[model samples]
Target: MKNEKCGGAATPRWFGYALQSLVYLAHHAENDVRCPSGEIATKVCTEATLMRRILARLARANIVEAREGRDGGYFLRKPPETITLAEVYRALEMTEPLCTGLMDTASDGMIGMEIKGAFSGIMKETEQLMMTLLEKRTVADLVKEVYEVKK
Candidate 1:
């Protein structure tokens, strides 16, 4: 069997889904007043249940609002141009990088501490950079970028 590491210290799944769903909602903002969970799942190529869970998280964060019953669905609580990736990141509480390794405390006592400090610094810097980028570019910006790329 291949030693495939699953669900390591990576960004939580909800973060990616929230980001993707935000972008999608922003792109369809003009046309899509309210998007059902199934539609969102289809567009994002994710399972309905997964999408629902993601949407629920976003809703909890106030990034998106959910409505129940017929003609009920999800919609961006705020304009996409105002939404930032940092907001989503914070909402999802994703702190670690995409990949991380456990510190070997036995081999090196101080080394682990040093590595952890360095990693913390790097993460803080990365988070700030991402926040700055996200602040400047909103969901609409993502839509524009996507359109340009598709063209």
Candidate 2:
């Protein structure tokens, strides 16, 4: 597949782009400032149109608020500390994880079916663990991480 705008290999390129843009905004959201999509595009290195689409989805999720006219732009709907990475993941991802095929029962025989069941169970538990971590982290946490890294 073609590389996504933000250089991530996620099935849909926009997922990574959206998260990167949000991180950028979270870091730069000083004074409750609203920034235009084009400004965000330049900072995050994506096309302005893609930023608009991503911002629109975030707006619908109430992760960000969109404004209109000359002074119009996008701003976080809530404080960065209040928005979990899991919330953004839900807004950007529209499908189950790519391992869903493992969830299907194998018609080959009892062994194949049993193996599929075992694999599916493991995958399900792993996914839940990942979700738990994401739910525990927020945009503000990510910003704090960057500051810590710089030290």
Candidate 3:
């Protein structure tokens, strides 16, 4: 619905935000500094509330850790190279196949049922393929990509 280039339905909007935040964190991590949620949100150009929500998910997944109080914020739990994109995707708890809603428009007749079934199978395969690709990449990889593009 929104006109944002959020990687569309194949990738959830927060996923992009999360990765960007992670890359930012990873960079600051090299300086041994923890990043505040507001800073990360500003860098990613998103609301602090939404950024916190995404960071909470990442924390729960053990991809990042959060601290409380004056010097508290968030940091990666593991090195960026060790954290795969697939882990981030799973951390977001995406329960359904991407674009599954497209199949919901099928008719109520037998033909519709068949089409739905076919779509279900296709969606499952598509998700599997996507996961396979994501598993090979990591936050560090994305950071390198961003730097390269800037060069």
Model 2: C-alpha RMSD to truth?
4.7
Q: Give residue 10's lDDT in candidate 1 (0 to 100).
A: 24
Candidate that beats the other on lDDT, 1 or 3, i.e. the better one: 3
Clashing pairs in 2: none
TM-score, predicted candidate 2 vs. hidden true structure: 0.73
Clashing pairs in 3: none
How many Å off is the CA of 146 in candidate 1?
A: 1.3
Each model's lDDT comes to 0.70, 0.75, 0.82
Candidate 2: where is the Cα deviation over 4 Å? 1-13, 96-118
Tens-digit lDDT track for model 3 on 4-119?
A: 43222223677778889999999888887888898898889877777888898899999999998898889999999999999998887754555667577665778887798788
Candidate 1 lDDT (Cα, whole model)?
0.70
Assess candidate 3 and give its TM-score to the true structure.
0.82
Better of 2 and 3 by TM-score: 3
| TM-score leader | 3
